[model samples]
Target: MNAFRTLATIVGGSLKNNATIECDDHGAEFFKVEINSSMDKAINHPDLTFLQGLSCRDSSSSTFGPLTLAQLSHFECGEVALSFCMLHKVGDACSAYYFLRDWARLTRDPKSTLSPPYFAMDSLMPSPFDGPMVSPVVEPKMEGCIHQRFIFSESKINALKVLVVAESCWLSGRIEKLPHLFPNSITMMVLSFSGLTEDPMPILEMLPNLRNLDLFRAYEGKEIISDNNFSQLEFLHLTELEKLKRWLLGTNVMPLIKGLGIHNCPNLKEIPQRMKDVELLKRNYNKW
Candidate 1:
C-alpha cells in the first residue's frame, strides 16, 4: 500500500525465493557491507575486489561481489552515497529498487506496514530454449509472462503506508499534468526517484563532493539540466525506461563509466540504430 511496505513485500519475496544474502562483520567476510569515513579509508581497507559472474539476465547479475579493501574504503560512514553493483537482467528492477528503499525506511522506522508484492505468476510464459544457459531465468514470453512474487506481514505492511501515501501524493500532481507519461508500473516509478543522477548541481548541493551517481531513466523531457552534459558520470543506469529514444540519439555520449545497467526496459530490446555494435549483436544473437 505504501512505498516502505511495498519494499518489505519485495524483500519477503526475495527471502522466500532464496535470493537474499547478508553479511554482518564489515569486510570480515566477503558478503558483508563495508563502511568507511573517507575515500582514503576506503582505499586503505584490505578487502579485494572480485569479479562477479551471472547466471541470469535480471538485475541479480549486477550485485557487486566482495569488494577489494580498496573498493570498500570508498564508502564513507554517515554519508549517504549511491553505490553500484551488477545484477542480472532477469532480476526485477522494480522489486530490487523497492526492496532497498523500504528496507532503509524500516531501519529508520520499524513500525511500517507493507503489502504483498503482486505475483502475476500465471501470466509468465515458460522459456522456449532449454539450452544449458540463456540469460534472464525469466524472459518475456509471447503468451503468459510469469514473474516471481513475494509479500510481507500485514503489520510490516501497515508501517510503510505513510511513506507510500506520501509518494503517491507527490506523484498524483505530476501524473495529472502528464497522463501519457505514466510509468509502465509502480516499480518503475519508485526506481525513477530512488536512483541517483549524473547532474553535478544536485549532487554537489546534496552530497559532499559528488562521488556516486544514481542514474536512472528520466521521463520524456524531464529537464535534468538546461544543457545536457554528463561527461563525468561514473555510473549509468536505464531502469524500465521505455522512452529512451531521444536520450540515446543525443550527440553527448558518456565516456568514462565504471558501472552500467540496462534493466526491465522491454521497449529497448535492441541498441540504438546509429551506435549499434555489429559484432556484439552477432555474439548476443548468436548469428555466426
Candidate 2:
C-alpha cells in the first residue's frame, strides 16, 4: 500500500477503540490535508523552528470535525508537518499521546501489542473536581493574527542564549566590555524558524525596546517569561504553544501592550492572580 493508503488503514482501524471520541453529525471526520510549497526556504534552512498547532478554523484549509482530524502538510523543502486537531471534550493529552504511540508501533509492525487504557480516572479526578468547570468558550476573532509558521534559526537561537544569559547581563553593566550591552540594533523579534530547546524569555528580557513579538511553536516551557519581562512590549502574538501552564506577569510587564493574540495554547491554565492588582494594566487600559 502507498503511504496515504497505509496511513488511512491504520488510523481507521485504531479509531474504533478511541475512548471518549467525539463523532460529528457527519460521522467519522477521517483526515484532511494540504501540501504547502511557500515555506521552502524556512523549512529547508539549516536552522529551523519547532513544531506547533491544531486549531479549528472556518477556513477551507482547516478541518473542524466534531473535533478530531489529522492533517499532513508537505512543503517544497521535502519537510512534512503532521498536525492533529483534537478537542478536549473528546480526548485529553493522555489519550492522544497513547493513540499516537500505538499508531507508531502499529505502523512499524502490525502485530505490535497495545497498552491497555486506564479507565479509572475518577481516582485522579475525585468528586467535586469532576463537577462542571469552566471551559474555553470564547474564541477571539483576530484579524491581525499571523498565520505563517515562526522560524527561530539555529544562529538566532544561539544569539538568544549568548545575549540573554545572566553572565552576559551582568558583564555588560560592569566594566567588562561587551558588544553593545545588548543587541538593541534589532528591535523586532520573531521566533518561528526552529524548534527551541531553551527558554527564550531570558533573551527577551534583554530587549527592553522590543515592541513586536511573534512566537510560533518556540517555547514548551512550564513557566513562561519571568515577572517584569516584556516591560516595553506592545504587540505580541503567541500561537500553538504546547506546554505553557502559567502567564507570569509582574507590576510593569507588557505595560504598553496594545494587542496580544494567544492562539492554540491548550495547557495554559490561568493568569497569575497577582496581575489583577497591577496598576500599570489598569492605567494603560489593557485587557488580557
Candidate 3:
C-alpha cells in the first residue's frame, strides 16, 4: 500500500488533483482511492469480468473526478492489480500510455530521468471567457448496447491478408491511372515511394476531392510546399519523413482539415501557422 501511494505521488500533476464542473461554478471533485484485499484465488485467472471489479465505479453520481485509482491485492495468489480510470477531458489514450510508462520506469529505478509533461493546451487554444464556466450535462443510459468479443488467430489473419493482397493489386492498378482517370472521384490517398526527389504536392493537388492523405517516406526532400490544394482534406498523416525540415501550406490549402498527425519526423522544424489550432494534432519526434 505504501509503495502504491508513493507511485501515485510520483505521478503527481492532474492525477493527484480533483476537479468539479458545474453550471456556473467549478470546484474540487472527489478523488477516491480504494484498496481491496481478497483471499480468492480466482483473481489470478484471465477472466475479463473479474478484472472489472478491481476498479472503482460510481453509478450514483453523474459527475465524478478526473482520476480514480484502485489497487487490488490477492494474498493467497500473491498478485497485485492496479487500475486507473482517467477522464478524457484530462487526457487521451496517448497521455495514459506515457503516464503508465513513466510510472513503470520510476518503479524500477526511482532516479530515472523522464521527459517533462506538457500542460500548455490553454495557451495553445485559449478560451475567450474568463468568468465561471458552464459544464455540459451528461446523461448516462445503457438501453440497447450489446457487447461481443471476436478473436482472430494467426491463421485467420493470414487468410484475411491473402484476400486483401488480391484486392490491393486491383487497387494499385487503379491508383496508377488515377490522375488521368478518376482524379475527382478518389477521396483518400496513401503514398510511399523510395528515393522520390521531387515534390508530390503538384501531382496530388489535382485530386480536388481528396479528403485524407498519408505520406510515409514518400518524399526525400528538405522542404515541401502546398499551394491552394487539398480543398476538402479532413485528415493528414506524415510518417517516417527523415529529411523533411520545413512544410509550407498556402492560405487556401486543406481548409477543412480537422486532424493532423506527425510521427517519426525527426527533422521537421515547424508546421504551417494556419494549422496551429487544429482540433486534433498528434505529433511524435525525437528532436522537434
Candidate 4:
C-alpha cells in the first residue's frame, strides 16, 4: 500500500493534488485502493478468469475526478495479484505501462534513481472551441457493452502467421477517402516493416482524427520531414529506426502535440529544437 501510494504521488498528476473531473469543470481528486482475500490458489487457474476477482470496475458517468483504482488480492497459496484501473481521459495504455514499470522499479529498490513523469493537462486543453464538436462515429453507451477475453497461444499464433504468409500480397496505389474509411481511428501502431523509404508523415497526417502514432522498425530511411500539418496529433513515438539520422519538422507542425518519445535510434543525434516547446519529450538512445 505504501509503495502504491508513493507511485500515485509520482505519476498521478492532478490526482496527486486531490483534483477531480466535473461535468462542466474539473476539481475532487481521489485515488482508491482495495484489498481482498481469495481462498482459491492462482496455480489452479491458467486462464484470465483469475483476474475477475482482482480488478475493479468504473463508470464513465461517475463524478470521480482523475480516477485511479488499485486492487490487491491475496490467495490461499500466499501469492498476491495487484490490479490497476486508470481513467482513459487521464492517461492511455503507454502511460499506464510506464507508470507500472516505474512503480515496480521503485518497489524493488526504493533509493534507485527514476525518470520523472510528465503531466500536460494545461497544454492539452489550451482552449475550448465554441461550436458543437463533430465526430465521425456515434459514441456507444457503456451499459450496453459486453466484456470478454481471448487468449492466443504460441501454437495458435504460429498457425495464423503461416496462413497470413500464404495469403498475403503486396498492395500499391493511393487509397481514396482514407479519412472517411477510418474516421474514428485515433491511434495507429507499425512494427517490423523495413520497406518504407519515403517519409510517412504526408500520408499519415491525412488522418483526420489520429492522435497517437507509434513506429518501431517500420521505415528504412535516413531522414524524415514533416510539413505544417497534423493539427490534431497529440503523441508520437519513434523506436528502433536504426537507419534514421535526422528528423525535421516545418513551422506550426503538430500544433497540439504534447508528447514525443524516441527510443533506440542510435544514429539520430538531436531532436528538433521546436520540440523543446512541447510539454513532454522523452528520448532513450543506445549510442550517439
**C-alpha TM-score for every candidate:** 0.24, 0.32, 0.36, 0.34
Off by over 4 Å in 2: 1-182, 272-288
| TM-score of candidate 2 relative to the true fold | 0.32
Model 2, span 131-235: residue lDDT tens: 333342334457787788888999999987766642222211112111225566445766653355556666676686777776666665666765656776777
Q: Tell how far residue 25 is off in model 3, in angstroms.
A: 91
Which consecutive 10 residues in model 3 have the weakest lDDT in total?
Answer: 167-176
Q: Could you give candidate 3's per-residue lDDT for residues 1-288 as a string of tens digits?
A: 333344444232232112322322121122333334443534465342133543332433454432434333343345554445545545566766776677678778877777766655655455558522345334456778788999999999999766643311112111222233433566777765444566767777777778877776667778888986788889887888799999988898888899988878899978899887886656444422
Candidate scoring better on lDDT of 1 and 3: 3
Superior candidate under lDDT, 2 versus 4: 4
Which candidate do you rate higher for TM-score, 2 or 4? 4
Q: Once superposed on the true structure, which residue ranges of model 1 sit more than 4 Å away at CA? A: 1-31, 35-77, 80-90, 119-288
What are the per-residue Cα lDDT tens digits for candidate 1 across 63-101?
333211111122444443332232332135664565555
Top-lDDT candidate index? 4
Candidate lDDT scores, in order, read 0.36, 0.52, 0.58, 0.59
Q: Model 3 reaches what TM-score against the true structure? A: 0.36
Which ten residues in a row are the worst by lDDT in model 2? 169-178
Candidate 2 vs candidate 3: which has greater lDDT?
Answer: 3
User: What is the RMSD of candidate 2?
Assistant: 19.4
Clashes per candidate (backbone, < 3 Å) = 51, 14, 0, 5
Superior candidate under TM-score, 3 versus 4? 3
